[model samples]
Target: MERKRGWDTLLSADTHHNAVGLLAREMRRASSPLYYPIALCLLRLLTREKTSWELPAMAFLVEALDCPDMTEWSDSILEILSRRLWSQCTEMHRLVLRGLVLLSKAPGMADGVRSLTPSLVELLCYTGGELVGMVLSVLINQVQDRDIPISTPTALRLAELLPPLFGYDNIHVQLLSIYLFQKVMELAVDKSKQLLKTHVIYSLLPLFFHWHHENQDVAEASRKALLRAAGLLKRRDLVKLLKTEQPWRFSECLLENDKRRAVEYACQALPYLESPQEPVREAALRFIGIAGRYMRGQRVELQVAINVIEDMTPDSAAVKSLALQTQEILRAVQRPQSSPGSSSLKISSRRCRIGRLLSGAAAGGQRRTYSGNPV
Candidate 1:
């Protein structure tokens, strides 16, 4: 007890190396009850010291003392370390974080550290990529334990953290965040799964089709995770997800299936023709062309397509050409199937001429009234 009391005085007096040496010598005496006092002294020195040298000494002491026997001391140490996260010292934060990571890996230390989930979630918002990755690693390990379920609040906090990181600038941070997200989605219980679907799926859909991502591994992982999400979601839920998340998928799926429902949903792609993205506009026009074959005599749908085609510019010549062909096919299919004679063909030719005249007049901002009089 005298030697332990003297060691605390030495630790507080700025002689950190000598204090650490004494603590190490005392720690070697396995039966000594000096671990708690030594741990308390090191934690105090860790939190109070602003010097660079003492930080590593304190961290080294904590690491050296880490064992199953020291598990009971984890809560207090974690609390002090978590509080240190708010400090302005980056080195101190790094030391505490490294200490936490080491402690979390020790036998019987994970459960105690798991209680710090709220603190860990808050740390996820830390701007430092290293800090965020360490926090994610700790949480990932904790969640992998089936016996210890993550609470709803922690899960929700994690969901909030996921979106920004999915597009994070750092590749390692991006990959680790994604891996943590996948693990959470897979391990979440049924109730948590619903929360994820409601909050997360909308953000994930674009990644499934992010063909431009430089990293093939990230793109492939996103695609696989998206397919997994699709499997778990109901068809109606998926349709809802695609409507706002990736409307192109919804339209493409409708076009591929060609169900009766496709007719109603095919119109959804019309807005995409006016999208600023050239690819989106082209895809929209392509879907419309395919759907028009089944839309013969559907005057409303055909008229909508015509108006869209008329709005196109020379820049969209490919789209316009496809739309024009589709318009002709639709008009041909509108004629009565029994009326396949030359007269029907002449009518169709005259109708095309009248349609062109109307389109030209409309483009020139001219309006004409047909009062049962010859042109």
Candidate 2:
């Protein structure tokens, strides 16, 4: 009674740090009598509206979370952390991640925190390398087990997010994200496999390009992921080429097999042009050249690729040369086709416009039209 009185007094007196620490230490020391109320008090503190109650309270909860046998409190603690993880406060984010990482290490807690997967997946797109690595680390743990079976909804979103991170600057981030992507594809609920099919298919080119990444571990992970992705896609030819490490064939195979999305695929490769690695940029440009052949006369799509490639004033002679070659090929495909009768069609269309204007002027004498349609 006296200890509770002292704790309430300190909180009421604004002993933010010292009092929270005092209570947390007591919880850890005497888990017998005082653990329940103090721990519950800290959990409730996370719900308080007072900004003063946030940092230290979160710190206290995170500290207490590091101990083992949190089975009883795992759900509540995870619930609190997951809710606060979306907070804009960086300090709160760090503490929430630390608490999550610790909890994720516990067996069976993976499901307790699995609902946070989509939010964490989006976090991979943000700036902090350490934060990205932490998010990937937690994700890798959550879905690593083959039996876990990520929900269909989470798996679809995961497929969308992981493709861009294959080129993330951090090595560990790259490896874990790719590997986790593979696991998500493998363990996603079977009923929704068809729903995830297109996402898996789109990932192939990115995964194929990354397989050539200079880092052997990243390269190997990409290869493994590509193989699994191929299996999901049921492309026996890709599987055979992968078995022989012949990624050189992925482009022709990709463009030949998925021509409907050829323009979209070319657009997908657009971002890789800016990759810091020359090899990756080289691959993206080369693929754009091939994609151009399939995109014949898709002027807007073709010009978008041409413009983005032209925008890069690369330091490498090879990349610059390839960019020019790709633009020339895409521009050639972008040109309008000539035929025996096309010029008369243009003359007739012009006559039709003039005839419409004359009839409108005859009908409504006040009707007006502008000739400044730009020469």
What are the per-residue Cα lDDT tens digits for candidate 1 across 70-155?
Answer: 56566667766776766676656766676777776765677777777787788777747687777767776676644456667776
Q: Name the runs in model 2 displaced over 4 angstroms.
A: 1-53, 69-72, 115-129, 331-375
Model number with the top lDDT: 2
Runs in model 1 lying further than 4 Å from the true structure: 1-54, 62-72, 145-147, 209-212, 235-251, 254-375
lDDT of 2 by residue, 43-91 (tens): 7666555466677787677777756544677777887887878778776
- Could you list the CA RMSD of all candidates, in the order they appear? 14.8, 15.0
lDDT agreement of model 2 with the native: 0.74
Q: Which model scores highest in TM-score?
A: 2
In model 2, which range of ten residues has the least summed lDDT?
366-375
Residue pairs clashing, model 2: none
Question: What's the lDDT for residue 297 in model 2?
Answer: 69
